[model samples]
Target chain A: MKSKLIIYTFIICLFLTGCFKENQIEKMGIINARGIDKQEDGLVQASLVLFQFEAQAKDITKLVKGTGNSTKGAINNANLETNFLLDSGKLQIELYGKETAQEGISPYLDTLLRDARVPDTSYMAIGEPTAEDILTVQESGISMNIGQYLHGVIENSASDKLFPKVSLVKFSRLKNDIGVDPILPVFEIKEGIPKITNIGVFQDDKYVGDISIENKILFNLLDESLLSEWLEITLPFEPFKKYKRNSSSSTTEKLHVALNTLRNDSTIRVTDLEDLTFKINLNIEASLLEISNQIKLEDKRVLKLLEKEIEKNIEKKYEELLKKLQEFNSDAMGFGSVYRYSKKGKPLTRAEWRKKYPEVKADFNVNLKIIHHGETF
Target chain B: MKITNVIAPGKRIRAFYLFFIICTVQLGVGIMGAPSYIFGYARQDAWISILIAGVALILILSVIIYILSQYENSDIFGIQVDIFGSFIGKVLGSIYIIYLAMALLSVMLTYIEVVQVFIRPTMPSYVIGGLILILVIYCIWGGVKVIVGVAFLFFILSQWLLILLYDPILRMDWSHLLPVLDASLIELLKGAKASSYTLLGFEILLIIYPYIDNKKEIKLPVFLAIIYSVSTLLITTIISIGYYSLENLRDSEWTVITLFKSASFSFAERLDYIVVMEWMMIVVPNNIFLAWATTYGIKRLYNIQQRKSLYILCSLLLVSISILKYDYMILQFTTIVSNMGFWINCVYPFILATLVFFKKKRSKHKGMNTT
Candidate 1:
């Protein structure tokens, strides 16, 4: 009787295993990125890059657009137009239009984060002008595909430390975090080609402003220790200032010495707890990447001059950026987070910190060392 | 009245299965959201709570081992029958058996809740819960040897899931762990108390002790198993704390599953699906062992066959699970269940052990001979 029961159980198991609703590869509209923008009529326009695979062939790409009152509504509207049901299980990135980003991305992020199907590591960025237009831009020669292109642009820069890796998860943390705001890589169509040029800075989810690529590299330095060589600095020195055979010639040509930082160590010292004064010290180790052929790297004095000039320029630029941060009342560098989390710093609310930020004093110090010269030296 | 012959099957478990059994049973649906629960009480110093809980568990488990040593060759049911007369002893054993069934219910319901949340959201809860029980019944049918074998296999295989934390570790903000020692001593104590949920399943060893072929060799492996479990909890707690801010972590449910959403691979997506699914392997043993314990209880108390008792238990379990099908209530009921488990498993084991000491000194085998 027991042996018969075992065989009967196995027979019932075979019959019960058929409830799974299989998602076939060919019939699924695999979404790679979803772009959300606020339309002029105040409706939320959502767009997606849908992947369609061919049997024994390369997959074809398609775009589906929809406009509705909310992100979920817009996605449902887009689903109406597609043959295969939209599956966002593979969503690689989420892009927001500049205008929509300024309107705030927290709403769209709320919908995405609520969906267990969405990957938390999806890259987040603000597309200049509008996310719809940016999502539509495509090129085959430069990029393998638009999603790969767009994702590669941000992912590459993030790894290079030009911008922080602001994913849906990290962005939500920064958004809800008391004292710190978040930033995202910015993309714009430059002469019909999509490019990630700068990062849009936010003050409490509002796209207040943006920093240039150079300033972003410096901003990233303040935020975290980076091992990258994307930081290239240009310095003009005396040797190339007047490269004529005779110094008396009085004709001067600039020696544009370019050095890339190979490694950087940044530290924040809360010098005074009362006024929230901070001294951000950056120790940079660099190598000569490019130079005008006039100056030689073998000369230690020349390297010293270049290092000092670069350091001085970095300090000046960083101070200017700090001043700009005060102007915008932005704490994207997480200074407020640093202070709030620190043991001794007095805790304050987000509004109070933002209110007091303009008056908070910040000092900048950059110490650059020439770790290696170019291939010649 | 042959205690060892009744519990021990022809195919006995080796000492190594003790390590995997203790570790596997320790981890389950509780780990899915344990960090947040512990953090809710202790905040960033929750890892310290796990350490304290581990130390306390070491002392408590040693006490249990000492009690087992007092009984020359007996399980908890046998010991109860020896200490008390058959009528009262049978009643206490029945209560204990019901407690194990409730434990089986709680474990099954918790995994069902997780499955609904992460995987089959639209599927019927009864179907999912019933399917899992079927698998548990299959494993339980294989008896203790098969159950221990599954635990051993899964313990070695599931260690790789820890590697999924690499991406989150890279992205984590270590400052979140700051303000260390911020939670007071009392809060840390409450945190340790809250941690008892995840640490509760190890006491199943009390029932399965005699089946251990090398009882003498069990201590080092069991101690290592506790160390393994404690460190896993410690590291996962620290990782979750450092990965998400305290406020966010508290606000977030299923701290571990939510963290798995961030795990990315080149070939796969939504790694949480993989995690929540592969996590079933770890949870099944908890159900199997508890179900076996209840069945083993039936065999000991009423002198029925183990297989028949399992069918009755799982059938009754199916009805109970179907009745408690609502997710929110199950989630709420879990805390109550864990508190009860803490009493029954952690505190009461020692209490029973101390009772054994008193009963032995007072009457010894006098009650046994009369029974």
Candidate 2:
């Protein structure tokens, strides 16, 4: 019994000896964001936005740059210039330059996916001109670290239904899924500040092209059910000329209308299997926010006319966006997934879907309901 | 050789604890990656395969219970001795003991690998392996009651981790589950076979049979334990198939843990870290139960003290874990043990049940002839 007590004490001491490696917060270079770019000499350049914790430091964050053949190697090279041990556990965002993304972002994502220490929730995006420029942007208007600022920007936009949230896990899912491609928010430096400008579309892992910001809402509506807060559309003035409250108030050829969408539900179905044709039906509920020209809203006829015009405008825009995606040969909207599941016997391979995606035809059906025309009318 | 064990009344436990013992034991390291293994064969229909495996397990357990019920207060060791004469029975019993040791070692090594990969990489394997073995020895020293108590405690403690799976469930893409009957029947059967490893540990029922008081009441608890474990496996597999794309699911080594990795809270950033550590609670019960089975078999078969054999077995296990350092070696070891366990736990029971039935019938006829 006495000897057993001794052994128990020894075991307790073994655990209490602190044998594992220690990682102090002050000594860890917590990387909040990392940007990758391709150099002219075929080297991978990594720009890391590190959180600075030192009380005496001049800034809340610091930029560390390095060049190597791979992302890990480049990060290692950057480590030599810092006293703190680089840790990627708190990483919030990862960005790739246009060139790097065009080449393919899959190779760069290996470190993120392989490292168990890294969180899978980090947002992924593309830098228009270069990732380094976006990470190193010096702007007086921004008070917080660039990495945190960029994360907040993306998170806000995603919550507002401006774009789909693409985290590391989601990106990998889309990249690996058979019939669908991945998309990322594109950030371009404007006047020494980074601004989300477009949606970067991809064919598999390689960036094919981008969709303009004007079409982001339409893209999202087609992708899934969404509740966007604002939408602007221009319609021919000929339709509403008779309902005008003041006849000569404005001579504009087009009437501009703004809407606050309450809800938008969209569904895509295979219309013709042999012809590879799809029909997209969209149901939208919105309240009028503003109208550039005067129209008699009290008349129920005017409201129906307005809804018809808005639906026509949306259908036209949706078709144009679909055409653009087809021209780019990218299936970012997941139409191929619908096509694959709708068909029977045997699964659709990525190659087969790729060959057939560009030739696929789609018809847009929009149903817009004007719930209310604002408090006045 | 004794056909029945005279277990002291003080050492006997109620049959209700079998639910905890069987459920906790079956839910060890195998579950960490069961989804990926089954998914590789069945894809989106992996849940169907898991359900089939569960039903198969219920059938196997019924056979095992029948075999145990053939003799009063007897375990696998005693029954084997009764059927196969003294020499051959001891040999087969020793082989079963070796299988238990391998299972215990595999569970310990897998936990260590998970720690090295997920938590502390630089921590030596001996430290982890030694700590686990010491805990196992400590629990076993308290005898079967302590081991069962540990299993019961840990089973209740670790259940909260299942709630974290809600995050992954929310993120799941339901469309991934479409085209359900895509996998061929043969492929689905293979998938069910693949789940044999995770669905193991219920076979411990054979070893712990004698200690169970009110043996007539065990059928309900034991079957309930299996149903509970099978449902758990089914839910995890469905979640994994829906949450991850097929290629991604195939690539992830520990799909269940990876599912937890994506669960984030405002206060805590990495839930997987907590889960991988809390998983030690789940693993400890598994180690203790297997170690107890091995030591008990040795004592019953070879007339050796359970304490002496336990110490020797644990020391050897510690040394082996330290030496088997490479990832590939650990992988190979796990594959070998799982394959062996599949046959021992799943197929061997039916054969044993048939042999026991014939042996009982023959003994009754001999008695009648004498009369």
Candidate 3:
């Protein structure tokens, strides 16, 4: 009995002396958002937007800067400027400057991939002009937590299909994937607030071009991300030109129609892999929300006309988008991935796909259905 | 020589604990990264690979249990002695113990690697290993009864994590799972071969056979346990395939934890931290049960006290973990052990069952001649 007691005491003492030296939350600089910029001398300037842990702490946001040849070195250099050990457990968003992103994003993102403490769901974006300047902005009117602020900017737009959802996990996976390229939300700081203005397109980890906000919805529609939302599209009021062209006080309000509960399905059929020709079918389902133009709701002819008009408009816009992607040799639409995984295609390397993608032609087929017209008179 | 103390096989256990013991032991560490292992080769067909592996393992496990039934309430250690005589039998027993210890070491180190990646990055590996080992040592010191009791309790508690998969399921894009049956025959064969190791730890029944009561009733529970674990793995793998795109699923090193990140409530930001910590309850039982088996082998072979063997093995595990460097090296170590275990635990049972069958026939003939 006495011997057992001694052994128990020895075991208890070991626990009392913890093997893990618990890192106190107070002594660590918890970074909220991080930004990286490339310099002319091949060094990177890392900017860390740190947040305090205390619930009622007065100064929650602090921007710290450091420069080094590599990302890890730059982070360590940034650590030197702070009084506490720097930590990235709470890192919410990572942004890269235009110069750094165009050169290649894989090198800057490698550290985040290697670090386990970093969350896979953290949002990533490309900043226009410079990421350091975006992180360094100090606005009294803005709610100051750049991490939450930037995350909200992207999250809100992503929900509306204006921006593609680009988390670190998807970014890392897409960069390594041969067929599908990665697309990250790109932002430009405007009027003291960051705005998601364009979608940055990457082919094999290097940012080559961007799709503007005007084309983002169309891209997202083809990508099937525009499902379960309302889309407002404007046409040139074709009926008005026929009816009111002779009137001196003619109103020139374009035809506006709201597509509600919108959903899209895309099918990529590889036809003749030797010829590098693929056919894509996009079928969309939705209900009409509002229409600014007065059209006969009971007329089957008008409904057909409306469907054909929307399909033609989408086909034209998608053709323009496809032409740009092919010119850039970017498979941001994942057409090559769909082709490679299809039953009748041979395996192709990313370089080979890049070469073949420029020559690949897609024939678009759009099917549209409007289930509800909102109690039309 | 029968073990007379509390750790002995004489203390009868319910047949149901067999279900939880196999489950708690096999379901740890591997399930978290199961998708990543085969996703690269199988692509979106990773779930189908998991299903194929599970069926093959169930067939193998049934054969192992049937062989144990032939020996009649005697565990594999005694059966080894009965079949090969004392000298050769004890030698084989010692080799199995070493194999089990290596398996235990891999599971422990993999969990420590997880802690390093997801839980505490700054803390040293040995420290996490030491802390978890201490909990394991306590369970081992209490004997098989304590290990079985904890396994049952942890299995029940950790099951709620299945419900959490619904959040990721809500985001499932069914089109990602298209191009079905695209994996060639050779790719699937290799995938099944790699998955044999993940289906290990059911062989724990070989060591724990004597303790379970109702010898005739054990088969049903064992079958249930296999079905439960197989379906659980299948569900997670299917969820992984549908939730993340094939391009992303292939690179998801921590598949389960990454899935949990998509599960968010209104109040919480990082849901993975909370879900991952709960997995400790599921992981610790694996270490304790295997550690106990290692010591049991030592006591039988060398006639040493179980306490002394436990101390030596725990210290050895601690020392090994201290020297482990880098994340990939931990992965490399576990992969090597798991590959070796695929041969020893998964395939060797079938071969041993055949040998045991021939030995049983000869003994029966000798008894008939005496009659």
Candidate 4:
């Protein structure tokens, strides 16, 4: 028993020694945002916006800039200037300036992707003016500070189909993908606040253009509902009257109904029957939030007119989105991915899919249903 | 006339020796860069490929068990010699030993590259490489039973890391798995071949077969050990896909490490540092085992008696190659290992199995002719 005890003690000591190490950094500084810029001498100037917590002062936002031949070198240089280590594991946003992003982002991104220290889920954006300029934007009022606000704004807009939520990992993936181009929420300085303007599209390491908010719905059709709230469209008197009078089911001559979007479900299927094409099907369920008090609750004629208007509106938007995407050659909606995934029945390389994507057709079938009605108009 | 027998089969191993075996084989070169490599070919479908590979591995393991069980008192080398003529069997056995040694060297180089790329950039390549090789040599200077025992313990301790990073998986977007069947059949098949890389370490079963003391009941533990390793791979693959889309996964080198960077806890801000530290825990056992295996291979092939000399020689070879000019050698080595190692682990075994089965049939016919 005594011998066994001695052996156990020896093992425990060995395990503890392995666990404990010296020269460890106790206090780690968390960087909220990073700004990347390319210099003329083939070096990179990195500006890291780190938020430090102190007992007496307001949250200190320190701008530490470093220049080096590579991202790691720049980071190490910056660390020399700072009292604490600059860690990016909790980094919220990464802003690449228009010039830097154009030079191609793969080299700069290598540091983030290769190192286990950078957070992959961090929001990535392209900055106008410059990333340093965008990161410097700060003001009082609004929901949060510029960095936090911009982070929320992009995340919020992405869910609302107002902008694309491009993340570090997603950007990394698109950087090499041939058929699809990369998209980042474009951050523009508005007064003293960072504003998410539109999605900046890039093809072959160059910025092409931005996908406007007007065409966001088309992209939304390719994604799951990031926004759960219903959309209410006021009934146009001419269309409402035409449908009400022509329909046979209801006695009411004029009725108004507002549709609240309850759910949006979509699926993309690729078929190679005649031409390479992708078919999109939308399943949207809406509740009637408001209706004319004059219209009876059971008015079939009013319901039919509401359905027709919804269908027509969706179809028109779908065609507009398709045309815009084709014009920009933006496969962000993952029509290209859909085509490739479908062909997994027989897989093709990225080179093969690129040749076939331009000739692909897009067909949309939208089913809109009014599942419920409000208590009062 | 005397037939000399220097050593006998069925030598007993201490329970602790199992840890070395489990750790060395389980904590392999796969952890550093598997997610990125597999993700390149399969994309979001990489996780599915990993899952399929895991199931396939389990089936292959069953076949190995069946063959190993056919001979209770002999090792794989002995069984080969018994099943086929001495000359052909030795040739095949030599090929297997050479493959094992090359794989050991390749894994050592890959591990050194990962450390250079991520952990210690300013540290000289030789120092880091030499340090790891020294650690492996120190452990391997013991014996096979001791190495296997240490591997088992190392494998157990390495699992603690999953608990630390469990919360980070919640943020993973499973939609990354969409359009699951998008790839052509050829692409998926190629992806499956790529996926076999992570599943290759189980081939150690063939080499370690002779040393197991409890022949009748050793199957369950060995099978469970393999399943545990595959399960770890599957979980990590799914988490990687969810964290990074297929497009992003292709660009990254260390998907699992990157996944940890996405993780944060209330107490710890950067979980990746801890993950990297945990990686050391995994690498130690793995390096020691591979080094020991290579040492054993050299000793067996050349009929060398001085085992320590073999250990030192194998360690120096690994350290030298690992420190080779880092530009394209590492990449070339990775590509060779992934591509060639696939055939060695996946294709060569089936070939050997077929030949052995045919030889057995021929010998049986000869016996019948004598009757």
Ranking of candidates on DockQ, top first: 2, 1, 3, 4
Query: For model 3, how does the per-residue alpha-carbon lDDT over A1-377 read when each residue is reduced to its tens digit?
Result: 99999999999887975755667777778888989999998899999988756556678777788899998789899988987678887788999998889999888876786666777677899998889877776765477677678887777864655576677766775676667788888888788777888888887788898887777767667655465666667777765444332324536568777787567877778887778778878888888888776666556667777777787777777888889988788888877776666635455577778888888887888888877787853
- Kindly report which residue pairs in candidate 2 clash with one another: none
In model 1, the runs with Cα more than 4 Å from the true position are A1-18, A40-42, A54-59, A138-144, A158-162, A223-225, A236-255, A344-348, B1-11, B81-88, B363-371
Q: How far off is residue B28 in model 4, in Å?
A: 2.2
By DockQ, is 3 or 4 better? 3
Error of 1 at B319 (Å): 3.1
Candidate 3 ranges with C-alpha deviation above 4 Å: A1-28, A53-59, A138-141, A158-161, A225-228, A239-254, A343-345, B2-10, B39-49, B166-186, B235-254, B300-303, B324-336
Candidate 1 lDDT, tens digit per residue, B114-163?
A: 78867888777678777778888888877778988888888788888889
Largest lDDT belongs to which candidate?
Answer: 2
Model 3 Cα lDDT, one tens digit per residue, B183-235: 88778767766665567788788888777767788888898888888788778
Q: What is the DockQ score of candidate 2, to 2 decimals?
A: 0.75
Fraction of native contacts (fnat) of each candidate: 0.48, 0.70, 0.42, 0.45
- B1-371 in candidate 2: lDDT tens per residue? 57799889999999999999999889999999999999999888898899889889989988998898888889998988888888888998998999999999988888899999998888999999888888998999898888999999999999999999999988887788887788899999999999988888987999999999899999999999999999999999999988888898998888898899889999999999999999999999999999999999998998899999999998999899999988889879988888998888889888889898998899999999999
TM-scores of the candidates in the order shown: 0.91, 0.95, 0.89, 0.72
- How many Å off is the CA of B302 in candidate 2? 1.2
What i-RMS does every model get?
1.7, 0.9, 3.3, 4.3
Where does model 2 sit among the CAPRI classes? medium
lDDT of each: 0.79, 0.89, 0.78, 0.66
Q: List the residue pairs that clash in candidate 3.
A: none
